[model samples]
Target: MRRAPRRRGPLSTVVGIVLLALMLFPVYWMVNASLQPTGNTLRGGWFPLRPDLGGYATALRDQGRNLVTSLVVALGSVLLSLALAAPAAYALARFRLRGTDLVLLGILITQTVPGIVVANALYGAYADLGLLNSCLGLILADSTAGVPFAIVLLHTSMRSIPGEIVEAAQLDGAGRLRVLRSVVLPLSRNALITAAVFTFLFTWGDLLFALTLTTTGTVRPVTLGVYQYIGAHTNQWNAVMATTVLAAVPAAVLLVVAQRFVTTAATDGALR
Candidate 1:
């Protein structure tokens, strides 16, 4: 006897396609605009029959400082966040401390406070210390915002490591630091990559803090660089789109490279 054919749900299929289109549309538009000529874009042309690379050239030459600033800040934020968060996450995951739960809860609660609220006080403090217009200062500020989330995510990943593995390391005459380096780190590499990627993306995309803290082009990130395309009388739409596309390339590359790590870390956390 022949078996009946299986069928997909109409609502589910429609919803999935809609979601896909919604995600893809912005990417499509960005690419389209990036290829458009400056004059054509300014005139509100919809499509580019004769695409040009002039906008990209202009963005690279004119906005190079912004690109460099973003790269430096992102790299710094990732390193700083991981350096501090890895140890804190390890301690929270592997050791039992008094008020551990309360500490974790406090970390989570800090995320609830708006960035703007913290920025107000932090701005004054940074100004006093002469850290307001520095790349290192921005990195420090961005890393602070990222550390709590990284700690929570890394803690979840670390907890997924079997307690027996840690105990076995201890039995093998390994010290806490050795166990962490040899056993915990190897197993938690995926989580570490995930944390770094998130931290990089957050620092790279930040504009409010960058704008408030940085006074010069040398420290202005790509998000602020895109703002330069806007003028009182005339906006450079082609350059804006081109610069935006360029800005997103680093994040896109990072995501592609670290996607497996992100997936594994998230799934492991969910199952646990």
Candidate 2:
């Protein structure tokens, strides 16, 4: 199920490079702004000749706990999504059950629903259950998106596994769980990694649920922390930019490290 790489002309390549630069200019500006001196507005130069660390110092001093909270929530969401998604994906992929398509369609529909709607809907239930301002609540809130996404990606990869291989494992005394662990999961490694990375990114970047579910500052994630920071210190754009840059680090690192696996997973899902 390999896809052929399309050839790009030099002109097209140049055009792509230009387009990419345009897209990434804002990111470059963010880093540039973060390195600039504290100011009332974005007045950074084209390049930071005399980069400052004061903004980062301020961000770390004030929002360090919130960064940790974001990490905890994102990691928790990834673990929970994988735990729930792997088994569910296996069932959906391997079992030729009736209404599987319907179930998948339901999940797809959920993705289309706006985050605000889900947050508003969950607020009342979270309030009633006294789960507000709790890490567990945020993890659960984030998982609403992560789980279905993981299931979809993992299911696609698992579906590409040979049924004969699964059958052989079962005949060799492997239970369904055993087969999933030993056979399907190993075969779907790329997709699993891709799902985990994206789930972390999603949960890390989440703000709507953070705002809607939590009340007090006791359990704020970095996103909420940065949001409130902006309101409190409007003049300190450098600190705000620095905090955002720090927040984006994990996601950027994950994407760079796992990009090959993600590409392979996408190719498999598309071609096979």
Per-residue C-alpha lDDT of model 2 across residues 109-214, encoded as one tens digit per residue: 9999999999998999999999999999999999999999999999888887888999999999999989988888889899999999999999999999999999
Which residue segments of model 1 deviate by more than 4 Å?
A: 1-15, 40-47, 232-235
Q: Considering only N, C-alpha and C atoms within 3 Å, which residue pairs clash in candidate 1?
A: none
lDDT agreement of model 2 with the native = 0.93
Ten residues in sequence with the least summed lDDT for candidate 1: 228-237
**lDDT (CA) for every model shown?**
0.85, 0.93
